[model samples]
Target: MEETEQKVGMLGSGSWATAMIKMLGDNQKKKKVLWWIRKEEDLNYVRTYKHNPTYLSAVELRIEPKNLFTDARDVIRQSDIVVLNTPSAYLKAALHGVGAEDFKGKLVVTAIKGIIPDENLIVGSYLSKVYGIPAENIVVIGGPCHAEEVSSEKLSYLTIAAKDTVKAERVASLLRNRYINTVLSTDVYGVEYGAVLKNIYALAGGICHGLGFGDNFMSVLVSNAIREMETCLTAIDPEADRDINASAYLGDLLVTAYSQFSRNRTFGHMIGKGYTVQSAQLEMNMVAEGYYASACIHNIIQQYDLELPICNMVYQILYNKQSANLEVNNLASKLS
Candidate 1:
């Protein structure tokens, strides 16, 4: 297929989805991009106003009116590549009527940063098992990049991982631009697991910050978080050669743990300030992926008998209702 003729579809409508659309718009080769938004009102609003109504409202949309859709299956059926950018918790629900047959021959890319709640599977594994997509065709997008920064065209780096390096490069080509630098890797398992684990660590960082821990402590916490991440990633994919120091791993962790735009950290901050898990979730307009990830990773640790102290602490505070002060203080003693 010709590069210009390859049709790409985006599933979900959120800040990250908006950012992807903006990136595709900047692609000099592709003229139009397909977008699937769940709500009729949102679809109409974007078509009329050329911008997402609720998220990333300031960025102007460049997609054609005919390309916007409310039906996910239709978009999947028509496009060669489908990008899944929905929150991990809602991913299954969003694809309600879509099935394995619908995903055949399509290149699936997941921009979701959290693991599937009950399944304990990352997006790539979930799609491969449930939707019957080939493992090589599944791509995972990881970042040191935030959607807010992408919207403003700020310089950002994205790591694209697949078992097939050639396919990984193709997807990277579609997303690369002057401001968006792309790096390709074949460590899909490591990249996906690292992405999921970082959010949990970011929450731990936020909780500490909200409790009045200074920059010095945060540096130590994040350093320990990277060690925790390396251990978890190695357990999941021992054969995949990966650098724990790469932007995909350490840089992503640092950004989420420190950035004002990190919803996971914000969610954690609220928890440290004495809010209940339900209350923190209710108050925020966005989904804090770490909240769901904490439970998922906690389950994985139990199954694998892994010693991930930071993940355990976040899980205790969020799921077990242990006080953040008490749990985090205990966590502090264990961190080097």
Candidate 2:
């Protein structure tokens, strides 16, 4: 196999997972793309039709039927790289019964943007601490890039982050195509935490929008949000030398907080429109990571004894049952 054609396995079947398959193929490489789809019917569906019937229903899978599995461990066993794209909330259950030895020597990549719910650990940390994968062997994919645009072949950029530059570039090779640009970073914690915080911030943006705040107020909100993000990232990993304005950090925060494709923003908009958290989730039929992330982050802030108004306001609204109207009013006074 060519260096770029390292047999890569994917452990998801959602829009991002679908888009990843597209990236691997569109990069025009000849590597085998293995996938672990949960449902047998969906597995059969993609195997027979070359497209996922539900998610991203358009791009051809390009994966051979024989390469698809319902078992995640099977996919892990056969590939040199494993991409965990499942929602953070469900990841533990998704990888249930797969032991630490299963991850030995294989490079682990997390395309997940949320923190693991109960543990409050980002996917990279979760994998390192729980699965015992060496920090250098772990890689993370962060965006300004969304799966929706990637499926349509729109130009987008991704920052592939790891402690090891060689490992980061290795995964970047599989994702860089004519339409997708890949940048490498050693700021592993910054990239992962930035991805998580951006969702919380985006949810706040959506809530503000649904409450009738105009672009002028939004500009202020975003400017403030970035500063809050910088403060949080620095507190989390002081040793990581990173630009807060880099595509992995600021670019991700902007798109998530403003883009129509952001499910976190969509979920927050629904909350502002008077839907209960349960009801909004039922309506979206999607997981808005920030809804869960808000609670997890609130706990972290308490441990670090940090003061982040935007993140706290979101946590209060989502978890503490504070009025959205009241919270926003309080939050507005804090922002410049």
Candidate 3:
């Protein structure tokens, strides 16, 4: 198939998925971009209104009405490249009826930044192991980019990592625009794991903020968080040769830890401000990837016996019924 003739499909109807649609619509090549929205209401709304009514409503969609779909299998069958942008906790449900055969010979790109809950595997690894997709055919998208900023056309950077550089570059080409810059890498393991770990650190930052910790303390907390992230990523894939300070790793951490649009930070702030886990989740009305990640990472790290104090503190507060004030205060003592 010709490069320009290859069809691309987006799976998910959230803010990030909306942002990706906007990016692809802006691509000069103008390839067909198929979108799989989980809800019939959202699909009808986007087709009728040219915008996602619930998420990133302000970004006008340029998708052709014929390309929007409510069926996952139909979208998967029609597109040569499929981008999975759902929250990691809901990914299994999103692909409920999708089987290995549906993904055969297609390139799968993951924009999810959290680990698959019970499996404790990153998206790229999970897809390869469960769906029979080859590692070389999977691409992972990492961001210092937020959906809100992308919707507003603010400048942002993205890292596309895959075992195959050619595939990574091809995917990057589809997303690069005037406001979006792309960098390509071969460290799929490090990029995906870094994306997952950063959310946990962001939650820690939010908890500290809710507890009234100052900017001075935040600096130390994040510095240590990056080091902790490096420790964990290295343990997972020591041969990756990735730079922890790059946009995909440290930059992503900074944005999620401080951005007003960061749902994870918002969720953590709610928890720190005396709301119970149930109450915080109820009020946010969004999935804080870090909340699910806290437990998954806590479980994964046990096998490595790594010291991830920030992740541990978050897990305690959210899952173990520990006091946020007490847990964050104790965490402060350990930070250098």
Candidate 4:
């Protein structure tokens, strides 16, 4: 690897992580994309085959074999930009031995769509508070794009957000290619919270779908969700001048809430069909961001004294042991 080339380190090997590696590789192989694969077996397989053995198996990996590392700190130590792509629930564990200084001067990008599980904080905030990384150095990836579609080389859109426009543009430039188009935003608060809230709404949509609700009600549910999202976002950050209809907010909400590839919706569908949370997780072999986000967002709602009916409904069903049928029915009457 040339020392002059930009080194980008990837911290997760899940479907989204693999898709990002694909985007970066597609944008330019000159970036020297380094990946931290958690499992040694997966690492060996990718090294040997040039494709992730488990996630996004069909998409050919554009990463160089020599850049794969099992230790996350090692990857962070070498890269100019570090991406945190692991599920938010497991993020703390993923950075096990790394210290704040390891991230001192690096640009940290978050592709995580969920809040930090027990922390009740968004990934960007968590990075700032825990690692001492400044807000300007962090970039957030927002999407209406699905990893499955990205793997298939379908055109998808991602929003790159940061407090600093220069950093956002740099990350956007790295991620954009023929299959992926990028938009840059400075509303880090709005984009991050919107991404987290969409999952809960998507899970709610899935539960409604599993309960046999027709498209008419689903449309009503979505319309109300976007309003609820706008309310919550504005309350959370009164200074952010967000449109709420941008690709980062409403567009992402629409896709996650309706897309067939949405794991959160799938998880909610299973829950509506009487599957336990543990069972649904085991069956899907994927983490539904909403399952955790439901609880986290619920906490945020209470702390902020914000009344988000859609998110409240999801929280009740998932964490309160309430009947999905009854909770959603009550919610339906409340939706305009």
Candidate 5:
């Protein structure tokens, strides 16, 4: 048996993808990683601008100009570690052409934080079922790291989760960068569940901001989000870490909840101010994962007949056409 060379490949070229490229580029053990962008136009734009100017303004991320692609299969075939950062709404469609049979012997990690609408499946769940990939083979990168902040060179932390503790450690070791730190978690489902649920809460936080509520009000919502996370996690896997109140969980909750850079938060703010979901998403020129996630999680909650107050309010605001302000106020009063 000879030493196997490790190569990294990432799918998607959004803000998160760009930031991830920079982080992976710092790996001395690995010289370069393959990044698959959706369009040649996006590849050209990043090659020239050195930043994803369309979304992340302050974070300057430039690739080697050679490590970009429009073809997904080509990149997938050549890399040993494939990191998926595509938005969840389009992830199924995105993987349509790529054959998972050829992807044997590769370590597939999910960098996406979303629950697929209607399907009500996390990216990891979808991959496991569709690709016959083991839960350990598909590590989920969860916790608090934000693409916007990473682009701006701000320090952040994240959790790498897999059923195999050793495999999770392998991802965590390769994932660390100057400003980014990653830890391994055995509770893969719990961590990913927290990551997905937090997106919905971030939208709620934005609605609170748009409704003219202060930090005090947002703090309550954030706490409520954690409670929701705990409930959802316990339903999926009891004995999951309860200390998610840490930086990775609550810390990520704060950034996505409050940051002007969060598309989900911004989308909610627009809805709170009277824009419809379609209009808000179009105006922002980005997919707010929370918008789709709120709907998806709501369906899951209803199917299980579970009570998720914050996510339910978000569903009412986006799907049921309820007033964001009124629903948030009602939710706040309930928690109060």
Candidate 6:
């Protein structure tokens, strides 16, 4: 592969995007990376405070005003590659205004994980079909990595998946650094699937806590989540990696399930504590993608007629009017 200069554009200015901006500075070459923020107020806030206080607190990042854009077409056209770090739920809507022509030549790497319920597609699948972008041009960055830990400078690793191994390597070259290690994978589907399903389990863990279940119960819930992930993903790709026991999977699940920082896990805890879905979502300031994903994935399973028992359980408790405690109790009793 030619060592060509590449300009990176970030689609959203959330915590992950800000942390990526910091990570990009470590690139050997001097590159102009643009981060798109829709709100003029957010632009001003970042400028004034020199930090993304709303999304990422304590870690201050200085962003250049010149690199911020509100115009999708302009940014997409200017960058060699675009890193889409927005929440999975907003991905399609965010790209609605931009035609395929804008993104035709650029390499797109996605850091967001969630299924589209209405479309019944993963991000890579949705982008390729909707935007006419080729699968070869789509790269998925996933693993058990968390943005909160990243902001704290904790060592983390991610898997980069693409149909073209060469392109995947290039993506690795661009992202790998002292703290972040990148592994290339041919199992794009499995990696992306695991990324989303783990969130469901993380929420389950949080719900256990919210229901006043202690560590022993939480451990069972977490273990069962990993088991569910392996079972479902292996059905899709038998050669798929089973390293979910690692930090990216189990570790991330624990943090999201238990940490005050995890909005999604916290959302589930609220629901388990008797907060209505609407109120629970409202109380959590950031996006709890699992809430939306639970609906979408549950629908996918039904449409495909695939039996995802744990995921279905989550959907029932969160949206199907099933009592959270009853669902847990029923599942626990059955396991015994």
**Whole-model Cα lDDT of every candidate shown, in order:** 0.91, 0.91, 0.91, 0.91, 0.78, 0.77
Clash pairs, candidate 3, are: none
lDDT for position 192 in model 4: 91
Scored against the true structure, residue 106 in model 6 reaches a CA lDDT of: 91
Candidate 3's C-alpha runs over 4 A off are 1-3
Off by over 4 Å in 1: 1-4
Runs of candidate 6 exceeding 4 Å displacement: 1-3, 47-49, 239-255
What residue pairs are clashing in model 6?
144-248
Per residue, candidate 1 scores C-alpha lDDT tens digits across 1-336 of 765567899999999999999998887765447999989999999999999999999999889999999999999999998999999989999899999999999999999998888787888889988888999889999999999999999999999998888989878888899899999998898888888899999999889988889899999999999999998888877888899999999999999999999999998999888888899999999999888888878877988789999999999998888888998889889999
Q: What ranges in model 2 sit over 4 Å off? A: 1-5
Candidate 4 at 328: error in angstroms?
0.9
What TM-score would you give candidate 6 relative to the actual structure? 0.91
lDDT of 5 by residue, 153-260 (tens): 788788888888888877777768788888777777877777787788888887778788888888888877888877777776787665767665677777788787
TM-score of 2: 0.98
lDDT of 5 at 92: 73
Worst 10 residues of 1 by lDDT: 24-33
RMSD (Å) of each candidate, 1 decimal: 1.2, 1.2, 1.2, 1.7, 2.4, 2.4
Report the alpha-carbon TM-score of model 3 versus the true structure: 0.98
Which pairs in model 5 have colliding backbones? Answer: 59-151
Give one digit per residue, the lDDT tens place, for model 2 in 70-97: 9999999898999999888989988998
Residue range 67-151, candidate 4, lDDT tens digits: 9999999999999999999999999999999999999999999999998887888999999999999988999999988999999
